[model samples]
Target: MTGSLQGETVLVVGRGSGIARAIVGAAAAEGAQVVAAGRNREALESAYKGTSVSVKGVDLTDEASIAALADDVGSVHHVVSTASARARGALGELSPEAILLSFHTKVVGPIMLAKHFAPEMPRTGSLVFFSGVAALEPDPGFLGVAATNGSVNVVIRSLAVELAPLRVNAISPGTVDTGAWDGLGEKKGAFLEKLSAANPARRLGTPEDIAQAVVFAMTNTFMTGVSLAVDGGQPLV
Candidate 1:
């Protein structure tokens, strides 16, 4: 419980983004053998570039794919999933397909992951799922995101109880400069500025911020059945 993961293996799903890359780097720095899993093999490999982290392809929405991934990986000391589907809209304005995909990505995917990978994890191992501040603030246009993330919070608690010694927890992050808003062009800066002003922390989160929280959750032996809000007081504001 007080030791490092020097010889442990960590499997990080959704390795194509800045946050996932940061988590991979942090874990590797902790001396854990890191495995990056994503739907795109090329992207996964590209994310690790010159690093020794191994890359694997796994579609979270597909049970068979996840099963195959678990089998191939054999055993792991921890699992962290950053995979998410972008689904945003008003209550009645959103497409059903989009809503379903959101559920698949944020909810069902983790469920399947636990089903397949939990058995491979030892009691000291943990599963860290990603949630978001939308679930806490309930923004008007992010009904789907709120629903999926809120459900994840509940799922983590339930899985913690059911999985017993295998810890299950969630991290809910606020708006971060993870390049997801890069498509907004010039407006991205203004958007982040507004977000920073609204949050008590007065700054947008960095991928490193969330990654460190994830490493804590993964390594902390006493934590489980809880959602740690890494939102920089965005929900309180």
Candidate 2:
């Protein structure tokens, strides 16, 4: 181990999902203290099952909760957010509540996190945000996800400049066979199968694939203000 972050602490937001869980796992493996925040206690435990990870249930959308989480974690060296809320539909097609649902968590959540935590992050600390291929290439069926993902992509670069000295980067992952498929319900298996067939790697990405990239973005001192695509050549389409 390079001990890059041997004594440093990284706070991972949205620890419930498999990708987020894997990120926490990887960060812990690399010698950094891991702190996970999310509303799901069981999922957070599962993520840090055997690691020395501190878990907290934080509602990222709530101001009080966000502030409290930052205070509890205190003096974080890195922040990785995998907090994506599942909501989809065209702009006018979805109800106001439904549209706000995904936007608040996925789009606004990271912004708020940065606002609250950036002040606490060291000058060289890093922040990695998750985006999807949908952000790079838009599709009609996923209007909401695509819109928010794309917006956040731009936000990463813009904020990287504004945040300065500290790093801000986005990780756009390809079809990862994480629980994200279960969200598709009835078509879960078929959707993953089709996605696997489309990938140049002949397989969909795993949580580990994206997690490694997340760790790189977080620990790589000289990198900042860029979005790294960890899609395994899928975006070639």
Best by lDDT: 1
Badly placed stretches (over 4 Å) of model 2 are 46-50, 90-93
Pull out the clashing pairs in model 2: none
Clashing pairs in 1: none
Q: How does model 2 score by TM-score?
A: 0.92
In order, candidate lDDTs are 0.91, 0.83
lDDT of 2 at 69: 86
Candidate 2, residues 1-237: lDDT per residue as tens digits? Answer: 566568889998885667887887788788899888898878788766776888888886787888888888788999888888766756667677776878888778888889999998899898888778887777776777877788778889888999998999999998887676676788889988887888788898889999889888988888887889888777676
Tens digit of per-residue lDDT, candidate 1, span 1-237: 233678999999985678998988888888899999999999888767888999999999999999999999998989999999968867889998999999998899999999999997898999999999998997887898999999999999999999989999999999999887777789988989999998999999999999899989988899999999998999888
Error of 2 at 29 (Å): 1.0
